[model samples]
Target: MQPQSADGASRDPTKVRRNLTYDQCYYHPAPLTRVHGQDVRTRSVRRQARIARREAALPSSRTAVSTPASSGFLGSTSYLSVFRETPRLSKAPDRSLCDEFEQWRTKLEYAAARVVRLASAIPFYLEQIRWYYDKGRFTVIPAPIVLDSLSQTVAHMESHPWNVTGNWASIYSDLMAATKSPLEISPNTSARQFNSLFTGPHLRFEFIGFIFAMAGLSVQGRFPGRQSLELGNGEKMDTDAFTTEMVLACHHCIEVCKQNSHVNDLTIWMRYMHILLATEVLGEPSERVYSLFGDLTSDIYAMGLHHQPSDHVPFFLAETRKRMLAVSHRTDKNLSTAMGRPPRLPHRYCDEALPLDLPDESLFEEKDSLERFLQRLDDGGWNRDGKFYPATLMRMRHILSNLREQVLELSLGRSTHPNYTKDILATYKFSQTIFNRIPSRYMYTSSCWKEMDAIECLARMIVRLEHLFSVLQLQRIRCQENSEATSDLLDTCLEVLSIVVDLTGQYNIHEIKKQFAWIYLLKPRSEVIRTLSFLVSWVRNTVTEAQPSVMVGACLELNNVIFKLLDDALNYRPPLGSGQEDARLRSVDTGQSFEISIQGTRGDLPSDVFNIGLASGESLSWLDDLDFMQTSSGLSLM
Candidate 1:
């Protein structure tokens, strides 16, 4: 790994900077493009930076922050503490950027007419995404502002399509030689003001990527599944087609900005925005997902966003940077825990605080809008007016995500430092304190959701799951270290699994389970199953080590709860025939193996580590069918 300066990015000493060797360069240009011809085991490329400006306008008072609901689960944490301090491997960002397909390497240059055709849809795309769309904190630029920018770009492209792009290529060729300054925005920057920063007739490639990306999301939202989805242009395509089209467009536009070493909010934003989409469509252990995540983290570090921004940075840019980091960092921790891969954006390097829990609109709506909203905030900076903003969800999730990182260090780090475990336990204690402080409105309540709209109900469900999922991941590791733990694998495992079942039994998540839309929301379902299935093996192995009578009873009785839960998940579905659910449930009675994609391994476990495939047969017969388990004399099917 290339050593970084005090700031996240390091400058090259060579005659032509940005020409540093892939091994020696801490920061490279883009996530998707590689300087060297091949993928390597370690991460070496440096990325863009985020420079912020204001923090004073935000409310200084502390209050209870609100959160949203949803759950996630993890697989085994059975790997013992093998070292004093774990040599955490950073596999995610290390090779996350390489895509060596011979064909895709060629740059795509669309004709003027084709560019116009796509540009024309920007307004339509902006509207559809904004329509009842809940542009949560995840989406930084407001629909109206993006729409305004698109209108200008489209008009300019219509008359002189070749003119703008030609000028663009020549102008940016110079800036690519060395690192560039970060994009800046005042805290109170308005729609017009923001457009002035990036919008031009040249139609910046990053912004172009942003437009098409937004367009793709709108299409995805409407027809979320892989089956029978159609773009309004009258072509019927599956989810993968949409994803491929979006990804290609992202490549076409973003490749230039990246090549030129241009790291604006738009470039970084588009890269992170597309990570999950590409992962779902392409499938996980996905190189595409890595490319996007790598780009996101690379951009963050290059921007020096890991450090707290000075008051000199613009407030709007600073807050935007914070929000973006929160999203990327939260995701980094998530991928780390799920795969046991080291986190790319570790918390130790990230000193930037979570963005204030104010709506994006509050910063731009009126001259005094931010100040006014500040007064209405609860002590925790949450909006207490009974309205849920995307910031509220991100803020809550950030806290949980940070906790997830701490949990990882404790369970996986295996530190020999004095009172290391005690320090971890202390953090665990603080977790409860944090959860207790969350506002009541955002807390999960099974009885209360009946009155809310489907979307609102879903939002609240996500909040709960997010919190519970974090707790469950922590507990699974802690319990694994202590064999004396009860059958429940700590209460969180059961709770996370239960909520996942309820998603099918009680709500519409089954309806929206597509890789195309809400990948994070849909991800936990597979993760929850994976975690519980591993628990079966963990419990079975643990009980076998105990007294004979205890082992027999434990194997025969204790696992019933987990077995039942797993059984419920395998069989439950949201009554098929809508979108892709039909295919998932089709031929259930055929007694064939269910094929939900499973990836990688936890330690030296068998290649068939996860036998979660449901038999759909009566009487739990599939449990007997497991081949690898046959060797375990003490473990029994009955």
Candidate 2:
């Protein structure tokens, strides 16, 4: 019988057993004691005493090596020397520590930047609230309170050295909870209590906070650069850094809401609002935007906001629900129209009553006051005031939603539903009536248009543009067979383009070019693109000498405006490159030379005239060839 060596090679078993001490055989105590047994209990006791004495006699340096089964032995290691070796565990590398420290430092810098950026913009936001209030814009009461809180927060950040990080869930939750109008009555609350709540400051400061935060984020995302002038007293602000911090802060706020298992209406609305800004204003084509939009619609349905508010519902809350619903509907409609997809929110599902055409001040009044106002409105006592802008806009949006549905139906070849054409024409006429109902004071007439405030003018233009768009869309369907209808549609499209061009001229180009700066302007600009594309295609296909000159002129004007608007909408900044003649440049130069030659030859015709003639001729020639092919195919079939 052989004993095993250190590397597991066979050795003399008897000799190995003889050499093994009681301490080394601790795991096999029963076997060793049995071999030396006189009385089993006494032998075991003796073996244990000997093992204890051997352990105590070991040097302090060897204690770690000699200690067996600290974690409880799974198997005997008496023959293995590997168990005696102590391996020192090294600390983490300096590079790893440095990297972590660097990350923390960067985060701190970003936080500081965000605080400064938010603080600097606080004054501007406060002034905006004041201005909106002064102008009778529908602002919540807690706007001032939220503004104060923001001011204090900014001051605290400035006064201290802090690294603000994490989800900020508590702050977000607190702010959102504050925005709920306390005047809101459940089915259980008394009417008297509700009335008292309504009269008190029930302005949702959470909403205000959300808007400010989102606005800060938007501003930061749009303008990432250094200001030429110093901020405050010689503070050279790094706007780009500030913007980065703001983006992170906004993301944190959103993430906090998202991480919650249950999202309330306020959070849902805030999230939806952010998505709108991201998609429409920021022009971010993220898939998350669409996903968030889906979630928003689901939330709206869950809250039952698609249905009309019951009489028991508070006026402020009802109005808020209606506005949120309207915004959701409009967002869905616009996105569907743009993407050529069916709208997520169907018009039939949203049968909520149109928002009241009353001032914000009227909303907080007693139930009786609102009931009486509704009675008057029902009896054809609607007032035409600038304050009605929001209600009017909502109504117009509803109409546009219907228009969009009709357009979708037509495009999908589902227009065979009876009286489709009549319904469309009726809608067009109704839209016009709505536009005409806007107070003459708010209307933009050439003589007194300049007298109107920019905001009011923008509102008027939006209404007019929407009406024109509806008319154009209606006429477009009929234009396939009726040249007269085609001509009418073309005119409507031109009017749309003209209105857009006029609106663009009214605003400072710099302001218009700013990211998400003028959301109202996007709708008209989009309409212009749509209308121009249709008109250009029509003009190319059809040859009409009577209005060729007029059509060509409109096309030229629209082309120029479209290009400019596109540049602005895309925030296009030209790259710094060498002025080299590429193929595209050479082609453009050749085209110009040809145009000059034609202008010289045709003294009566303008360059545009020649260009239009050539383009239309080519299109007409292509159409003729197509017709000839159809006729030849028909003959062959016969």
Q: Pick the candidate with the highest TM-score.
A: 1
TM-score of each: 0.61, 0.50
TM-score for candidate 2, please give it: 0.50
For model 2, the run of ten residues with the poorest summed lDDT: 90-99
| Over 4 Å off, model 1 | 1-101, 107-124, 131-140, 155-189, 224-239, 415-420, 487-490, 501-505, 508-638
| lDDT top scorer | 1
RMSD of each: 15.8, 25.1
Steric clash count of candidate 1: 35
Candidate 1 lDDT tens digits, 168-222: 3332332232213345655456567767656553345566677667666666556
Put down candidate 2 lDDT per residue, 569-638, tens digits, no spaces.
Answer: 3352323572442332343323221112111111222212111221233322323222222222112110
lDDT computed for candidate 1: 0.51
Q: Distance (Å) between predicted and true CA of 74, model 1?
A: 13
lDDT values for all models? 0.51, 0.43
